[model samples]
Target chain A: MASALINVPAKAKRGDIIEIKTLMSHIMESGYRHKASGEAVPRDIITSFTCHFNGAEIFRADLFPAIAANPFFSFFTTATESGKFEFEWIGDKGFSETASASISVE
Target chain B: MRFLGAIATALLVVGAVGAAEIPLAERRSGYSFMKPDTKTMQDDDTANPGMLWVLNGETLWNRKTSAADKACADCHGNARASMKGVAARYPAFDKATGRPIDLEQRINSCRTNHQQATPLPFESRELLSLTAFVARQSQGAPIETGADPQLAPFVAKGRELYMQRQGQLNLGCANCHDDNWDKRLAGAAITQGHPTGYPLYRLEWQSLGSLQRRLRACITGIRAQAHDYGAPELVELELYLMSRARGMAMEAPAVRP
Candidate 1:
């Protein structure tokens, strides 16, 4: 199991490009690393992250082995209406975590 | 006899006054050396990654365990009130142990003695989280430290160690922190080594770490054999750093590069 934290404006104006920040606790192990005993550690990374605004996809990203562990993302998305924003992160070993934040727009 | 007593009284007052004069500005908070963005990251709780540890600590504070079934909150009540400025005063003298105890040792002492719980391992997440959480309570408070007569020997040793060169490099903490502060080393500006912000979030580590961990890094940087966690020498060094940092505001759980 994994945990996540999301930051978004509690209130915003319509059509405002609000900043969204997120952090997830994951190893994001690049599968290329070797253990002390000369064994290759299997890769485990968050392969995908998607943000949904009111059930509609606003942004999505396909992560790679290069992404650092405990991936943090800060992006901007226009506020269309007062609604909930959902975040989902999927990774190797069937690791999936989700979080949500809501914004009130005038 | 009355004349002798008056002379002793006069000497006592002078000594007390001399001891009370705090030399501020001899040290600077790590925040001043940080990039503007880094400082902003530390200033804003939402953006600070260190807050994650604080959040966990809050949860842990209220959660009960053991046969006695005690939580820190059960005894301390609200941490915000009870723990305020507590971190700023440590590594203070611990009368029970008749020794100096840093924040980490204090936390462990509480766990084993009061909570009846197993002590968390050094550098463990739970310990770091708890220490960070407690230290955060003292944010913005000025740090004040002095060596009590009982604790003077440790402080003296710490000061001696701070100036003593070690390793192949033969460099001491004072060489850089005191003599060459405000200069750049390896492209990073050097500030007077201050311990105010500890159990802090470091972007380089991408995790929270304690002051001892940072001190060990410095020791290793000089190619010296590093001390094990919770070593007495490290505690002494911490005490010295705190005393050097007297009157400076604490910014624990601070963000740094």
Candidate 2:
């Protein structure tokens, strides 16, 4: 969950626009290997990620095994009231992460 | 139980014998060019910060810490004599803890139990200096951590962890570093999972870091869950790495890209 914050200047004065940025870091395993006893290691990878702001759906993305580890993404959202932003990541083996940050509207 | 006891006894004897051996300079075979060059980044902009740490360690060796008012020199005398060959056997099995203990842990233990000083944080200059000082004595000596029966399981665990697939990408460490050592990812050449030279000054990190720190970086780089510093899993993995480089010499505070 290594992440950084960047302040973006808003071009649109009011409504909806997409904010796009990428995160770097996602272990995208193709799941191809032999175990200690010489058995094949199984496949697993992050499949999806989504973001919401102040309980409103804003953006979403799907990932594949080919995506490099520490998956990065860019997205957009309709400007409503500036508030809290939430991000979620869903992956194989039922792994999931949800992170949130606050945004202010001027 | 007898076999285990015998192995433990042998390990103790080896430790005792190692205490008497002269620490040699590390040998550089295939990767001689990786040695610190003038172009290598200086430590904290100081001239050869690693060397400075070693010098500070010498001072620390003689100066008594307030905790117990006992200096490393109090018991060991000249480090060139008493502490030789010690670093070459580290990442060794600690019978008391029942786990593989690296040189850093051993030093802290001595500081706490013997010298009565508070253990320095992982990357502190004091710890690093003392570590470099000790490792310098073993520069060219062959690493000789004897096999302990108790360490086998952990080594196996570490091996499994190394090859296991994890993270969003589901890539295991071995996939890139081992199997693909000769392969190119992005623009970098993937090197073998070697821990021969560690506590390295890295260009990417722009600072000195331990091998475990590097391991954590790799874990993060792969988008896998990185274990906490001093975690059992990381210790086990470190033991496995040390085993892989069984005969390699210790090259602490080395430079790396």
Candidate 3:
């Protein structure tokens, strides 16, 4: 039920290093904490996240239990041509989400 | 644990000054101590994790339940307009009950009486979501609780609870919030125990939680038995905190460390 938010410039210069920022709403429970009832909270975290530009891989990260909830990432990618930038996040319990933004290179 | 002595010593001085003459400048919202990044999260609607709960709440508000056969929107209309400044006055006196009730109880009563639906379970995700959603409407409004004559007795009770020491550690809320605020303990700053921002997203919890949830942690920290989520004691304390925090900007669904 978590929606992903991504920020990418609508237009960028060819060969420019464009900044991309993304944030996702997730608990990313590490399974180490105990509830009031003394039961351990189960682990549930985004295991992998990847970004592709024009159908080519650009950036990827393997998330771990140490990552904070509502994971946020900031990175730069070389703008090549006008196309869609696709992002995907895969996590425990078969959780997966994808979002895309269109980029136009000047 | 090592800082208990520092907290206690500070409280002794504040307690000796009596209640009336304390300068208003001492009152600071918990926001002041937040890391810059955390403050940014609270300020940015797009980045705050609490927005997730608020969005979920918006959906639930329009969805009809089996018992009511009507959605909240069916009667209340757009919450953005109807709920504006509503949260600021909460923990208000409920004339029907002849007692003060917090926002959570008010929401439950609406479910029971109007919607004919069972009250959402205390601290449940649905309850937190709805509460946050309603509270979001009051963002930037100033807190206006505790001024009613009928609410005076309850507020007094809450004040008494705030100052009374309890548990094995013999700690009262004032020990840290009123006296040692802005001071560090275990590398975390002590905030002034304000209730302006509730149903807040706490980084430590890694999720949105109600004020009662945070209060329980304080009680447990001092080795005291915690009250249940909807206990009257908690409600009274919430009322007192709100009154003490009057005029502070409401930041419901705030992000915290």
Candidate 4:
């Protein structure tokens, strides 16, 4: 039911600002709700996300349990002699997924 | 009485046009009822959560799940190439059962018969994924169900069910969808019920679900005992809906509020 979809511009002029969009499918349960049996649902969410540009950290987000499921994030960064943009998300239960996309900058 | 004469003629024209079915010129896709942002979300695969299932479906199609050691791709080939415009004619006649079966059932039938795999339970993630993927291939094709002669009786049965009042509220689908569509209901626009999209993404559910799922919700909303998933009655209703919306573009994996 949940999958990751990340988008990045394939090409951009040097020094141009490019938009990057990331979506992660997660329950993001806030742990505040009680079931019919009065048992608390455990909190599950991506606690942090970061993007590195050619090995340098460029964007970071700190998520909370209150975040909605399938959280989508969009941001912009200047396109410099692009090599690769790597993304990492860490969450509850040691959940981690990483993806890499490369862009050509002329 | 010139004004009275003109009003009588207009009412006569409407009555002659078959009041039960919306006129062709007024038939509109649910897309017209959506907010601009929701439409944008559906148009952009990157933002549409339903696409996630479609991507996984591609994986499942090639994974080869059964003891038969056959993948959907093995026989059907690339879904993009073989499945085009296929979903437009679902709730189709099945010779073996002599009953109509929706696309979901068709997929299961293929699995058990051709792939030697147990039928995926209705409402399972895999089923939703595969259906969305297949239906996506028919995105712009017109719905063409009820074309088979064998399906005519079922469509007739479906039409009866569609109009019959039921449940605690004694409200039938026709009461709202056919009679009062385009009007506001509980702050939401009541669209003329169209099933051109199936296995769609409903933000209320925050996931991709089948047409049957939506139907069950409506049934329950009327305080009715929601039919079991894969029930013939549900498929019948689906048939009736598809036939009603014939020639309309399909929009599977559609985003809905």
- Best candidate (score: DockQ): 3
Model 4 misplaced stretches (Cα beyond 4 Å): B1-19
Q: In angstroms, give how far residue A34 of model 3 lies from its true place.
A: 5.8
lDDT (10s digit) by residue, model 1, range B39-135: 9888877678788888888888888968669999999999999999999988888888888889999999998889888989988888998898899
Report chain A TM-scores, every model. Answer: 0.95, 0.70, 0.96, 0.95
Which residue pairs does candidate 4 place in steric collision?
Answer: none
Q: Give lDDT tens digits, candidate 4, residues B26-76.
A: 999898999999998888888888888888888888888778999999999
- The i-RMS of every model, in angstroms, reads 2.4, 13.0, 1.7, 1.7
* lDDT value, residue B28 of candidate 3: 73
**Which ranges in model 3 have alpha carbons more than 4 Å from their true place?**
A8-18, A32-42, A78-83, A103-106, B1-22
* lDDT string, candidate 3, A27-100, tens digits: 89888889999999999999999999888899999999999988988899888899999999999999999999
Question: Lowest-scoring 10 consecutive residues by lDDT in candidate 2 chain B?
Answer: B18-27
Residue-wise lDDT of candidate 4 within A1-106, one digit each (tens)?
Answer: 4468999999999999999998877767788988999999888788999999999999999999767777788999999896899999899987888888999999
Candidate 1 chain A least-lDDT 10 residues: A1-10
Q: Which 10 residues in a row give candidate 3 chain B its minimum summed lDDT?
A: B14-23
Ranked by lDDT, top first: 3, 4, 1, 2
Better candidate by TM-score, 2 or 4: 4
lDDT of each: 0.83, 0.66, 0.87, 0.86
Better of 1 and 2 by lDDT: 1
